[model samples]
Target: MITRPRIAAAFAAATLIALTGCGANTGSSTNAAADDFPKKGKSIELIVAFGSGGAVDTASRLVAPILEEELGTNVEVVNKPGAGGQIGYTALASAKPDGYTIGATGSPSVVVSPLDPARGATYTRDSFQPLGRHVVDPAVIAVQPDSPYQTLKELIEAAKANPKSMTASTTGLQTGEHFALAQIQEATGAEFAPVHFAEGDAAAAAAFLGKHVNVLVGDVSGVTDLIKQGKARVLGVMSSERAPSLPDIPTFKESGYEVEASTARGFSAPAGLPDAVAEKLEAAIKTAIEDPTVVKKMEELGLQTSYLSGADYEQYWAGQEAAYKKVMPLVQKKD
Candidate 1:
């Protein structure tokens, strides 16, 4: 019995009310996602760009439990290793910027990957939001126990004489070790044919131990156990000074080479992450990295704990990117 004009007006009112309610609900849900982020029962994924048993993977695993404790949520350490950390880094960059997914980052690998056109990296340094930095492990050059190269000088001399006859193992292309080799070659004319192990230091170490590569160009933490067990003979440590853990080993400078390189590892989330979520993540990471227990564990593994807050970490990476750009042409393959 309703009039046609009255029915139309009622329908319009109903439609307006429904639309308003939907808009309000959407805003509330979004605010809730930011305010109550990392809600209970929700888990965070911590991605490691390297394979298991590598330095990056080890540090991420060690931090995951403490991060979980601080965030009141589950933290899962996921390894997505491949293509010299490109696969994992790509995954991290492409993930939603919800702060629920973060990954371990290292340089000069991460800093230089996107710089190289040949790498075809999808993400640049701006693609990630630096949460915090953890450690800086100095590079080391080692040979098997029975190798004839007794000192770094001997190794350099032999490499210069043989050019590409000597094969060296690197974690991957554009990694710290590769850069170190390029520096050495450019400075001293020593040529070493590098064998890139895209997996990480774990695989590179295995290749050196199995005699597949004549020399191992790796980091101190990656080869500390090998040196202790007398399975590898370290010729030089690529640091400004001798490593405290390896007091007996000398720096490359002391051995008459000016090469020095180290890899710094840290955590980062995809860019555009909510400020609230990012702040919480950065604070939690700072706590975990500064934890005494975590420090002791990292020391035992020969990884030096060097914590840098989110802002400082970003600046540091920017500086590294600038410095490495000058040397990129030196490392490029020559036809």
Candidate 2:
């Protein structure tokens, strides 16, 4: 028999008891107990770590309506931007476990925050109860339309030719995009100065468009408009596969670089929530993810669907955190 991770086993046990309604002894008696698992008449608040119009915000907005319909309750999406998503995640961790407040969190928050010293965040994968994973946003390397470098090779050559002159724009130091760029630099032995922007993706895009930066690294959602309008051209995507929205772009691995990173969006309620409440929230998220409207919205935003319920989501996060830990030390700290 294949051995599973300790957390996976734990999650499987919990899920079997909660979701499948399977007990050691099953009969009409178990059905009565299983009927109590579905929670009714509850309101859930979903906190989006980034500002409005971001990938996370857009995803939450698209899924919240469908979730509202599925749960037969009110679901609200609130924007809480700060510390590259730690502020909101910290807040979510501290909320009451009544299952009323959930947060839509992705990379940097789930994987990178724990590795950063400045954030001062203490919670781990055990802090919150995972509802489910929703989408995966792949990182992309893009440059201003008028830039001399048209391809990843050309950009690498330019950076290799002049180490610090060619600067790349990213949200902040040690962020997901920053890490992706660092991976590129390490893989190719090319050096480019990093430009930090305050407003995340929008600021990074603006810097590139204004000729303040030669390159910008971020998720496809943030730069989709720029790519569509010829303001920016994606050099490569940092994913195992090419994004459907940008079919012409090649993956970093495919382009002879071994860098692959993807940010995942998921829902989580505060820890210690009742199993019934968690089940209800999970079911709602499942419904939202399967909804046709959500599907279309995700496709338009260049997001990949990935659903993981409760224990599975938590275990997946643990693996992500471990990977980030290995990659964090390789990132060059910015002053």
Candidate 3:
């Protein structure tokens, strides 16, 4: 016995009120869901862009367990080595941005690959979202123990006397080692014969040991064993400060060479990750990098600890890219 118009008005009012209540509930639920997204028991994959036993791979492995402990979840490390880390990096870039798939990328991958178009690389530093930087390992110029060039000055003099006669083995053609070597050469105005090795530090060490190359430009970890065994002698470290592990060795700056370079290893996620998820992942990485276990491992490997959060890391990366752009062209212009 209600009039049709009154009933219709009543229905409209009820519908509007219900819709308003539902909208409020939806917003609250969304905020709650976001707060609970990375719940306990979720798994995170830590991708390494190198083979096992290498510096980046080893560092990632050391950090994974501690990250798992911190996040209260299973953190797994996977190796995807090829194309000077471009292949693994590409894989990381293509992954979902759910904070589940993270990658440990470093110097040459972050700085050099993007600049070297001859390598056919696609992703640049901007392609991935920075999580945090964990470690910095300096490069060193090493020579066989029995080599005639005992000091960095002696080697520079020799290179100046005979351009391209002083063969120097590096990780790859346009790798960090190569960049370091180029920087040193530019600083000193010396020419060194380039011996490119595909297998990285190990092969570079082998080339020096086998008398195939006169010098080897590599990381401290790469030449530590050889130097300890009297198989190689470090000429100069490619850093402003002397390495703590080899306190007796002099830095390039100390040796009168104006050069400073180190390999920075850090974590990153695929591009377009949700801001909330990126925050969670960056927090977890910061925790992982500061963990005692991670610190001990990095110190044992002769790596310096320097952590940078997502935005800060990105800013630092931009500076690095600019530096690479300036330096890479010089390297390419040389013989």
Error of 3 at 311 (Å): 1.6
Local distance difference test, candidate 3: 0.80
CA deviation > 4 Å runs, candidate 3: 1-42, 333-335
State TM-scores per candidate.
0.91, 0.83, 0.85
The most accurate candidate by lDDT is 1
When superposed on Cα atoms, how far off is each prediction in RMSD?
4.7, 10.3, 4.0
**What is candidate 2's TM-score against the reference?**
0.83
174-206: candidate 3 lDDT, tens digit per residue: 677778878877889888888776544665677
lDDT of 2 at 204: 72
lDDT of each: 0.92, 0.78, 0.80
Comparing 2 and 3 by TM-score, which wins? Answer: 3
Q: Report how far residue 258 has shifted in candidate 2, in Å.
A: 1.5
Highest TM-score scorer: 1
Arrange candidates, best TM-score first: 1, 3, 2
- For every model shown, the clashing-pair count is 0, 0, 0
- Alpha carbon lDDT of residue 185, candidate 1? 94
